[model samples]
Target: MKLQPSAVGIVVADMAASLAFYRSLGLAVPDEPAPHVEVPFGALRLLLDTEETVASFDPSFTPPTGEGRVGLALECDSPADVDTAYERLVGEGYRGHLAPFDAVWGQRYASVLDPDGVGVDLFAASS
Candidate 1:
């Protein structure tokens, strides 16, 4: 059988923190903690697993170090909305990686870090 893209799984250290981060980004994930939680976004399901969940089967699961090991992006309705989202997240104590700016590529772009220190970008085209 042919293989097609299905899900994106992220092993998180703290379920509550990770869930809060994704929920702030407008994902409909519930504000609950679980060893493994799945959220369906359109066609792809976002799979969240705790450190123990991964290690349960693999036994060799060691969380990778360093920042930006994973990248997630969201597109807003307009350039201004991108700034609003970025500011709101930062205002809530999340780390803002790059302040909102008009990228040379014809889009407003910004970035913020999640609880796991992964960079999540916010971008939108000029309207």
Candidate 2:
């Protein structure tokens, strides 16, 4: 059998904070409390699990640090939207990783870190 890529799993320390971050970015996540939550991320599913949940299954599970963590890029409607999203998130006390700027890639890009320090990028076509 062949393997299919379906979801991206992130072990978050704060469920509410993580869910709020995504909801702010226009995702439709429910306002419920649970150790595990699944979000419909476009064609793929974004799976969220608390640290305790993972530890229950694997005793040796420990959260990763610094670089090489899961990073996601969200596409916006326009370059201006990227800036708006970046500002809105930062204004709401989210950690801004990279300010909005026009990249050489022909897209306006910005980045913010979730409560767990996961980097989430925002981008849109430069007009």
Candidate 3:
């Protein structure tokens, strides 16, 4: 079976807040749709959805309770970008999960949470 990923959907508690956060990161809402925004990350696109919309799939699905429950990892072009992105998230009112640091796997990384409390990791391979 050939498997291809078209999108990654994030169930957000507040669509407006989530959209604003993503837009602050330079993602653009597609012209075709009035509300949804699309952030292209290489081969995949990140799709943000409201709680009500996500409940349509599974009524029992709920937002993560605490830290590190759901994470979205994004690769950066350079280690500096990881630091920059992390700082930007913090400046925009996102709580930092961890400060930017060199990972055991040789990548520089940091994490932040979205409006829905979903974790987002920014990383770049160490040279």
Candidate 4:
């Protein structure tokens, strides 16, 4: 048996806000009222679905109420870029989970929560 990574899924409370937040990070997502929306990344797809969508299919399904359900790391061109991206998202009203800092592991890293509270990480190799 073999396993392959296919997609990253996020359950959102508000489609517009979720789409806006992702667009700020350069994803070209279209505005649609459909319960689900997705953007392609090479061979993988980043998928977003509304809580209502899940419950419609699975009446017993319960959406997660805590953090850490998802962790998405985005690479920047440079350490400074990581800082810039983090600051931009924060300025746009996103929650900054962690300020940009140089990790002893040899990279600049930071975290921000999307509109739906999913962790979106930014990182770059220390130069």
Query: Over the full model, what C-alpha lDDT does candidate 1 score relative to the true structure?
Result: 0.90
Model 3 lDDT per residue over 47-112, tens place: 766667767787797754665566788888999999999998899898888899999999999988
Residue-level lDDT of model 2, residues 64-86, one tens digit each, is 76734889999999999999999
Error of 2 at 68 (Å): 4.6
Candidate 4 has its poorest 10 consecutive residues by lDDT at 33-42
lDDT scores of the candidates, listed in order? 0.90, 0.92, 0.77, 0.89
Residue 43 in candidate 2 has what lDDT? 93
lDDT of each residue in 3-119, candidate 4, tens digit only: 999998888898889888988998778866468998875578999899999899989989888778889888899999999999999999999999999999999999999887789
List candidate 3 stretches off by more than 4 Å. Answer: 30-39, 56-64
**Candidate number with greatest TM-score:** 2
Between candidates 1 and 4, the lDDT winner: 1
Model 1 per-residue lDDT tens digits across residues 1-127: 9999999888898999999989988898977798999987668888999989999999778986778788878889999999999999999999999999999999999999988888989999976
Q: Residue 119 in candidate 3 has what lDDT?
A: 80
Report the Cα lDDT for candidate 3.
0.77
